[model samples]
Structure formats: structure tokens, C-alpha cells
Target: MKILKYIKTNVLIYFLIGMFLNSGLSLIKPLLLERLLVIQEDQLTLDMVLSFILYGFCLHLIFYSTMLLANFVSNNLQRHLQLRLKNQLFRKLFLEDAFIDDEKVSIVTQEMELLYDQFFLPLDLIIGKSFILFTTIVFILWQNLWLGLFFVAFSLLRPLPQWLMNSRLNNSGAAFSKNQKNFHLSVGDFFRGADTFYFYGVAREKMSMLEKYNEDYENARWRNEWTNNIVFFFNGPIEFFSQVLPLALGLVMQERGAELTTAGLIAMYIATMNINGPLQSIMYSVSDIQRSGVVRERIFSILEDSSVEYSYHTVDNVSELVLENVSKNIGERILFQNLSLNLSQPSKVLIKGASGTGKSTLLRIIAGKIRPDTGRLYVRTSKGEEFSQFQGNIAYISQHPFFTHGTIRDNLTFGQEFSDKQLLYYLDQVGLTGEIPSILDYHLINNGENISGGQRLRLELVRCLLREKDIVLADEITAALDRENAKRVRQLLSSLPIILVEVAHHIDSEMHYDQMINLKDYR
Candidate 1:
């Protein structure tokens, strides 16, 4: 039902109409064939043969035309569905606190394709084929009620094989999907660790592990395929009986003069053939849909899930921040406790702590990345805006900053509109203009691996400056820089006219700070 929400109502109606027309058109050929078979040799004429040929040609043209139209509708439906689903996936992935696991990643890349192919694409065909089966059955009953009843009974057994093996098919399908994802992850891990393995002289062992994963994936595929084959094996005989038994019985009824004429019996036989394809196709399509249950659920789960939607409290300008008795713990270990600090008047504050002293954790808490266990943080703005915590405004510059593979402008603006002049000005402010040529046009690959560590940190600072964020939380941003670059970064931070909260291992005398809190004293 949720999936149907993406489909346009008018378009769906048009498709169903096309399917019905196509099914109706399909009956014409069978009826024409029956007419041909019933014609006596003595009565056959050139005009009659030519007329039948013309009708067949016309029927085929209309049939294929309707088929083409239905195909276009199905493709368009898939496109619309994919578009909506893609937007949902993109929003979920970019939201704050979005944790992307392997399954979610596979949902975006692999499972989406599987869902379209197995479920969405075939869904229209399933409906269309069901229509064909129903119409064919009705046409047969119109010819002879007893033969139609026999067909209805035999058709009941058509789905038995699928039902009997439904659970196995579902389980195997899920297992195959799981193994496929695992195999992809294993391959990624193997490639990611390839350099390390070579350095450690254990590449062979890692390769062996990758081979094991491959074999497992293959085994799962084989199991899923063979299980389906077993279902098909049972279905084959049922289909044979569905087609052959009806014709044989029709012949017997005609022989016994059971209100069945030769023409009617032959027409019913022709109609039975029509029913066979759609019936078998419907059964297999149902099985295919059932096989896609896991993937379908995985995709729908994300669509239906309520992601953590935070209403950001907007402020004109942040002027103060206060942490009251903030405490954080990792199991039994208290990283820090009873930490209290107040920063006002757009002041500079430095938190000095040794390793394992919750320095980064504290900064993340202020940036609203995580919450403190036992205390609250309050935020105040120059326009008398007050809030219990920061929301959607603070700029966080981590030690290992986030970057995508794009030009410097792309990284800086993040698709936001920023003029070249404004971006270059910020680049000049962060001293990045001197180091890289064509500063804005410089491309970064693999999270700015092409740039130096200091340059990467400086780009992050430039991003904050471009955004004019009122609050900045820098976590050991200059730790990896040399003395000159470190001094440059420290001066840039100290010169910014914003509320700055910096946590670093080393405290420089050259750095100006209105407040300094050693986290150890709070403990």
C-alpha cells in the first residue's frame, strides 16, 4: 500500500485498462484459430482465408500496440517509484545521527535494483496475466460449463507447488540476499586491507579468507536456485496436466454427446492453451514476489520508519554557552564528571585534557552530536534568544575532518550558493590560497587525501567562516600540523569573532582565551 502511494492514480487506471484490453485482444486469436479448425474443407474459400489473415494481422498490430503502451506505463511507474524511494533514502542517509550499516548501504545500491526487478517490474505483468487467466477461463465456460469447471479445478492445483515450497523459497531467498551483502562487505574489507596484508606478508591468508566468503555466497546462490528448481519441477507436471487433461476430457465429452459440439470442444481446447501460459506465469510471478519479501521489507522499513527529526531552534547570534555539572561515562569509567563552564560575550574557551579525558566527547556534546549523561547545556544569543542546548547552528571541526571527492568549491559550499570572491576570501583567511594553486578549483580525492593535514583542517575552518557560524567546536584540529601551520591555525581560531570552544592536548601561550578549563580538575 505504501508502495502504491508513489504510483499516480490516473496512470494506474490507464495501465489497468491497457492490460484488460490486451487480455481481451488475446482471446481473438484463440477464437480465430478455433474458427479455422472448425471450417469444413469443402467450405474453405480464398476470401475466407484472406479475411482471417487480415484479421490476424490486425489483431497482432493492436495486441502489440497495447503491449507497447503497457510496457511504457510499467517503465514509467518504476521510474516514479524509484525517484520517490531514492529521495527518501537520501534524506534518511543525510539526517543527523544517521548510522549507515552494510544492509542500509546495500539497500541503496543492490537491494533497490533487486526490488525493482523482482517485485515492481513484474507486478504489472502479474496483474495482466491474471486477467488473461480469468478471461480465458470465462471464455471456456461460455463454450461448455462442464469443461470450464474441470479447468477451474485443475487450475486450483497450479499454485500448490508454490505454496508447498513457499517457506523454503523465502528462507533461501533471504539467505542468498544476506550472503550477497556479506560477500560484498568481505570483498570491500579485503581490498581495504590489501595494503596492510601485503605489508604484513599475509596476503595469501587474506585471499584465502576472501575465497571462503566467495564460496559461501556461491553456496547460498546454489541453494536458492535449486530450491526454485524443485518448485518448478513440481509445477511442470501440473502445467502439463492443466493443458493436456482438459483437451482429452473435452474430446471424451464430445464423443459422448454431452452437449459439446466439435467446434465448441476445439474452441475450449484452444482457450485452455491460452489459460495455461497465464496460469503458470501467475504462479511463478507470485513465487517471485514472495521471494522478494525480505528485500521489499528492507526497503519499506526505511520508507515507513520515523527518522529522528529534530526541530532546530534558530537564533540570531549565539553569545554564550554554559555547561552545568556535565558528566559522561563509558561503562564504569567516568571520562569526566561535574564539569561546569560558562562562556559569554562571544568568548574564546580552551579545554585542556590528556588522552582518555573525554576532551573530544565533551566537544561533541556541545556540538549536539551526543548528549551528556548527567547534566544539561544552555545556550544564549545576543538577541536574548535562550535555549537549553545548541541546535543546527554550531560548526564542528574534527581532527579528521569530513570531505567528499570534489572540487574545493564543492567541499566548501556543499552545493550552497557562494560566489568565487567570497570563497577565495575565506580561503585567504585560512591561509589556503598560498599552499594550493587554483584554490577553488583544486580537486580533493578520497576525503582530501591529495591535500596536507593542515590544509584539510584549514579547509574545514574556511567552511565555518564561509557559513559565518556563531559557535565553533574544534577538536584537536591543529594537532597534526607543524609549528608554523599550527601557529597559523591557532591565530585564525583566536581571531574569529565567534563563540569558540576548542579542546586540544597542547595549550599554546600565544593563543588568547578568556577561559581555560582543565577537565581533570572537574573530575
Candidate 2:
């Protein structure tokens, strides 16, 4: 059922049709050989050979058409499955009460891509090969029962070597994938702190680690290849036996004076050889199927594990957010505890905390990014009614802002339907109007790579202002900026009417908050 979950009905139908055509075509080869051998003693006419050629061509056409259809169906199914899984993942992320862990998300994304490749292709091959194998066996048994038995016995031996190879490959593959992930993580860490590396003059040392990882990856690839080749080598002898056994037995029968036509012997030999084709196909697909099983298990585990749930209570509108007896824990370590706070609209509060005092977690709880383990959050609307939901009223800006590779205007507007004048006004407000040559014509690289960190942060602030949320939860938004830019950003935020809850390490002069709630006081 787990594997079948990925198989859509239309895909199954397409596979069956393809299998039927392939089996029918495979039967033709053996039948044609039998007919040609039967007529070998007679005067082989041009018309007879032409008829045989036409029959073979028709079977080939059927095989080709079915193969194409199977490919089409498999591709479509793969596309749909990828989209469906992505959509589900997006929904899960959106509905969760906290930001998704980036590391976990990365792992899930890679596993999903691998699962899509492994499941659909192998399933198609397995379905088609099974049909061919079944039809070949049945036809051979009907023609000569003893030869069919021999084919079955020899075919049973094929799976052993394949099974051993598949086991070894899968184990090695898992190890390789893990090592590869570690390598990527290490490389990411190096590049993300290029400044540190340059300042410390440790670039060469870091590069050496990358080279070692590459060598390990290459070694793993060769190991997998060598293991598979050994299986193929073992299979070659089994395949040879498949063809030779029928011929040898047939000759013995003929020598013993049992009537065995040349046509019959040839047909039996072809049919025996046909068994290996399907068996080999199955072995190839089984490798992918095993890999897919690992991916499917990973995907299903994410889908099944419960995250934070949305509150059932609804509000007409929310004006104030309140957390009473709130606490949070990651595993057994309490990140925060007994933190009670209330934030009202059109007010500003500064949340000051040490590096690891959970200021960001507190902000997340208020912004509905996280649910406190032992407390209730009440949201009161401007009209004096309360609800348990946070929606359409809060904007959260983290320390590092995300920007799509695009123009300054696009980053500010965030793809929202904004007019030219509105976009320009917001950009100007954030002091980015002069940075770009033209407000309407500015282009930015992805993640704002072409821009400085201060510029990106300013753009993010502008984007948040444009959203016009009632409350803004900003976590170290100005940390990357120089003093001048930080001062400007502080002034701009102070002027906004939204209730601001900011997490800051340093508070400069003349930038006063209505309430400065230090997390250290609570601790």
C-alpha cells in the first residue's frame, strides 16, 4: 500500500497497456524463429520471408508505441506527484505555528526529488516487465512443459545475485548520501563566512576539507559501480545457461529419437532466452524500488508527524495580543517560562535580551509563529471581542531577510499588486530611492547579492511597511547596518503607526521606545 500510494489510476492503466503490447511483441520473436526454422527444409519463397518481416515490423510498432505511451504516462505522473508533494509541504509550512527548521526543510526537499525519480520509473518498468515475464512463461509452458520448468528454475537463480548487489548498493548509497549532505553543509559554512576565512587566512585549510569530501564521494560512486558490475557478471553466466540448457536438452531428445522439430528447438531456445530479459529488467527496477522505499518512508514521516496546530477560535478583528503564563521547551530544555506580556496597537515596545535569552522565541509566540506549551494567547479586536488566532495583522522581520533575485522595487513590493507611485514612495521612505538609477528600472540579484547587507535590510523594512500590518515584530533588523543606516532605520520605524516589538542588542541615542522590556529582567 505504501508503494501503491504513489501510483495513480491513469498511470497504472498506461503501464498495463504498455505491458500488454510489450508481451505481445516479445511473443512474436520466438514465434517467428519457430516458423522460419519449420520452413527451412522447404523452398523458402520471397513472399514467405516478406510476410514474416511484415509480422515482425507490426509487433515492433506495437512495442514502440506502447513504450512511448508508458514514458508519457510516467513523466506526467512524476510531474503531478512532485507538484502534489510540494503543495502539501507548503501547506504544512504555512499552517505550522513556527518557522520551519531550515536544515530539516533542506533534507526533505532533497529526499522528495529522489523519491520522485525512484518511484515512478521503477514502477513503470516493474509493471511492464511483469507482464512480459508472465506471458513468456505461459507461452513456453504451453509449447513444451519441461523447457518452461527449466526456464523457471534458472530464472529463480537470477534474483540471488541481484538481491545481494541491491543490498550492498543501497547500504552504500545511504552512507554516500549522508556524507554528501555533510560535505554540502561544510561547504556552505565555509562560503557563508568567507569574510572570516579571508581575515584569518584559513581559505586553503577549508578548501582541503572540500577536496577530501570530493574524493570520498568519488570513491563511493566507484564502489557502487563495482558492486553492480559483479552482479551483472554473475547474471551473464545464468543468462548463458538459459539459452544453452534448452538447446542441449532438445538435441539430446532428438538424438534419443524423440520427435523434436528444428522449429520447436529454436522456439524453445528463444523463449528460454526471453525469460532472462524480463528477469534482468526486474532486477534493474528492484534497485530503484528499494531506494524509493527509503525516500517514501522519509516523506511519509514528515507528513505524519504533527507540528503546531492553529487555534479553532476566530476573531472578527484583532487589536491587541496577549500571552499569559506562556512557556516554551525544546525537548526538555525550557527556552522561556512564565512570560506574560500584552501588546496593543499603535504602541512601540523594545525587547532587549542577551544572545540566547529567547527574545526571538518570545516574538515568535506573539506573532503566532510558535505556540507556548502551557499558556493561552488571547487576541482582542478593536471592537472589544477576543479570539485565539493571529492572522492578517502581524508582520515579522527576522535578522536575515529573504529576497528573490530581482529589482529593488520587486524586493520592496514583494510581488504584491502595487502601483508605480506607491512602490516609489515606499522605496524613497527606506532611503533606497537614490541607490537605484531609476525606481522603475532597478534590478537586483537573487538574495540581493549585488546589494550590501544594509540595503537588503532596508528593502525588507520597506516591504514590511508596505504590508501595513497592525503589529510589526522585528528581530535584529538593523544589526547588519552601519550606525548611520541603523539610525535612519530606527527613525523610520519610530514614525510608523503599527505596534512594534523589536529585538535589539544596542539602543542608540534619541531613538526611544515607549516600553523597553528586557528579557534579562524576566529571567
Best by lDDT: 1
Residue 17's lDDT within candidate 1 is 77
lDDT of 1: 0.80
TM-scores vs. true structure, each candidate: 0.92, 0.86
Could you tell me which residue pairs clash in candidate 1?
none
List candidate 2 segments past 4 Å from native: 89-113, 116-119, 164-170, 255-260, 291-296, 306-316, 329-336, 383-385, 478-495, 506-512
The sequence of per-residue lDDT tens digits that candidate 2 reaches over residues 22-90 is 565567778878867767547788988898888778777877777677667666666766676676666
lDDT of each: 0.80, 0.73
Q: In candidate 1, what are the lDDT values of residues 1-523, reduced to their tens digit?
A: 7777777798778778777776765577677777677668998999988988988788788878877877776677678778888777866654445555664567787888888777886786788887778788889888878788886678668778878878898898888878877788888788878889999999999899889989999998899889878887887788667767887898887687788877777677677767767767777777678768887887787777775434455566777788889999989988889888878856898999899988888987887767799988988777876797567678888889989999999999999999999999878877789889998889899989999888898888888888887788988888878888888888877777778888888888888889888988877
